[model samples]
Target: MAFALPVWLAVQEELLAYGGEVDPESPSCFDDFDDEALFQMFHLTRPCIAFITDSTRIRMKKVALKKPTLPVDAMVMVTLNYYAHGVSSAAIQQRLRLSQNDCLSIICTVSGVIAGMADQFISFPLTRAARTNVALKIEKLCGITDALGVLAAAHFKIRASPYEKDTFRSFVNTLGYTSVVSQFICDSDGNILSVEKCCVGSTFEQDLWESSFKGREMEDELHGQYWVIGGSSYNLSKHVLTPVSEPANEKENRFNQAHAKIHDVMRITLGSMKRRFRCLMQLGFAQEGSLDKKSNIIKACSVLHNISKKFSVPPPPVVGKIEPLHPGRQHSVPIQINPEALKARQELIDCNFSVASSRQDPPSETVTEEDL
Candidate 1:
């Protein structure tokens, strides 16, 4: 990830040339410059700085200043801009008055340096004590009651659909999460005395209730079948379950139900798919238009229109003209379609038609033939 040593050296030289000093109190400090100018200068020099800092001692030894290449200031400016905003080189070039090629070069070099240095910033897995501390923090923030030497089981809900509704169930006999839970218990100081290891078994209503109420007490013992945990402002109710047999058939059924729900949402809702397609199309058009400055807006619109037609969706409406509010000036407003209108149109399409096809002809029907 480290940039070439020469690139780093060049960046430092550029910074020095722009009345910038390593020390903050120096006569020629970066503070003397305006924000825009400082930003521009930083954008130009950052790549070289990253390169030099990230390079290993062995790599540094090989670097030489003989053949000077990309300016340090330009590389730094591009790199800083990229990190600040996830914009492409072409956009940076237009805004900064630099050539697209130069912008691209700096971005690539800085990216290489960042990639090399990524391991230094990435966090490692927490130890047992650290994990316990995290749990303690969560409990304190959430105001949930905790008991010492109690078994803690963590569960994850598989998303049935990306849009609308969250479905969660007790995870039983899952290898990975179960293993993690076991590790947490073993590592803790006398938290879990013993574990009842059971093979995947069928799920029963009683088992669900027990699982829900294991560590916590029930409020109403007779009719109160659920466990309530205290939240920051209120209590959250969790249904209790008894241990259930995990059968292959039951797992398959659950999986099918989840899968079917997702499929129905995606296929049946035209609004969902239409919105996704429109957003993607707009992004693609923007990228394409930015790359080729001479690209005609009309051509881009036509292409999008054709694409929409192919999908049987209506094209965005065109605004015929735009006039400037002030007279005798070149400044004029740009016309664009309203996103809300587009969404409404998509919703209408979704509600108007069913995705499933209807049967047209009957199985047993006699047709009258012409007299031959």
Candidate 2:
């Protein structure tokens, strides 16, 4: 009787407190939405939601937690709300009825997981032939010779570090606040090929760029007739081609013209990314947390960006903060250019001229991407 009394009292309390039952004519959430509407809300197709939930479950299987805790679907829901809407944890808690800490944990965990799946989300072409394929696209779209991709740095505004004074001395002030910087390599199609984060805001872009994996990879992967484009920030190298400082001839002038076209494509790509995930666009991440949360947010966004492109996910409203055109000039950077690299660059310059100059087949020393 005592046990039954407790159950009866609980049921009475539930009914009395909530005004009959909690049921209603409609629920203001994904439950009532159609497939198209669901994607608009979640930024994920139904199949993608299932795949992510399945992946999260498989990853979390080793960790034993209380049974009454939120299921993997809810965890993913918590994470998706941030990517889709860039809402605060409190708002998510109110909307989804989960704790703020739960949302934080889920975001960090899911981001870290998705960040590691770069191979699946990013299209990093290997083998010379594969690279040539990418280069060909640049030629088709931007009319640049043997161009593989465009390189740029993206800055995310973070909360002013408690060590604001110390950071001032240590880093570039991102409009009077601490910020994080990541280097991006994107193909002609606006697909992000590589994203290297974890650098402090003050770090000089050229130095940060050189230390990146893509930097070293550029040295080895590109050879005779292959190169990537960068802004004036990067020093010219065997594999990297930057705009000419002073156009000595019509050929150099023409190269800059083609360069601007390709760089514009990169700008469009960065703009679309921030518009799709507004969190990176605004400034409200937890100030105390290490860049772990912000970095993961960005990492997850990158993956989702790829997923969006793949599935044709419509982007949110666009308000760009990442400038597509680059700053910093090359003359300011002192260069001890490698003799071989210098020679190679000249050959490339001459090669571009030949392509620009004539319709005849390019000499063996140069590669005309049109034939490829």
Candidate 3:
């Protein structure tokens, strides 16, 4: 009779094979990839990867426990690959030669580490000097004088969940998938200034904004010195500007055109982020955890996206229409406008976006629709 190998021996053989394939001590396995290859695989350049690894290494070391600890760089690579591609965890485990537990642990640990850096990477300009600086950048880019930032929302698709199933389902008939909506505010250079916690896809952008901490205090915070632009779906306030419903004259048309240029900043910011970390396009997080965890993963992706911008990483090419950040299926109906806000918008148009104003002081850069 043939003798069978012991179960322990089989396990040991598997461990030996994995050890041979990936040396836990040497993370230089990444050195084999060129700049393009690294970007293609992880959506980050080598220098950027190094920066992230160094920043999060200390925290990761504290949490590590099990044997065959992965090098900090290797852990970073695994996590980044997970973010860049929303592939199954099994695929990552197989390719990286890691146990299922190890792969999941690395992803969770690295994600939390990156997300913790949000306060550093993601912030809005609240002071007068800072707000003025942002306004200047917006003026230089699109001639939208006194505009500090742009606001919009995107629907991030996710798997079905038993909790809040009705709320997660897309309210619109055209979009049949379940998703969570996230709001973003970005500056003229497409740098994200702020991101809100994820809400159900069924939530209206205006409702989502109104319920946010920032939105509640925005008018008081601005004190009429600066204005944040948003779509017609949002309520018009003293510090918020929305597009004119029907252009009665050439000046009104000019105002809308200039408003569109600034608005594209948010769109480009959202699109580039989704392209870089495709997990946002189709979030793959397990539904068992608190919803906050999923939201943090999204936040972590935005933090990484901002870091990529700091490193001058070029965005991936657009495949088609830049994914719409405005989630409303149908155009929003015009709401009652605040008298003060209406006057402010009119004054803004007459001063900066009028036909005469355009002739006197042209925009520094003319952004074509195709450019977006």
Q: How well does each candidate superpose onto the true structure, as a TM-score?
A: 0.26, 0.76, 0.80
Please give, for residues 107-216, the per-residue lDDT of candidate 2 as tens digits. Answer: 77767766665655666666678688888888765556777788887776655546666654443433444567778888877778888865556666778677888787
What tens digits encode model 3's per-residue C-alpha lDDT throughout 113-205?
778767767878877787888898787766677877898777787776556555434432226666677778888777778888686666677
Q: How many clashes does the backbone of model 1 have? A: 33
Cα lDDT, model 1, residue 256? 26
**Which segments of candidate 3 are over 4 A away from where they belong?**
1-29, 58-69, 88-96, 161-176, 222-224, 285-289, 327-334, 356-372
Task: Residues 82-153, candidate 1: write the lDDT tens digits.
Answer: 433334446547655777666665555544443333222211113455445534532332212121122222
**Which regions of candidate 2 deviate over 4 angstroms?**
1-31, 35-40, 44-68, 89-92, 169-177, 221-225, 283-289, 319-322, 325-333, 354-372
Better of 2 and 3 by TM-score: 3
Sort all candidates by TM-score, best to worst. 3, 2, 1
Model 3 error, position 162 (Å): 8.4
Ranking by lDDT: 3, 2, 1
Assess candidate 3 and give its lDDT.
0.70
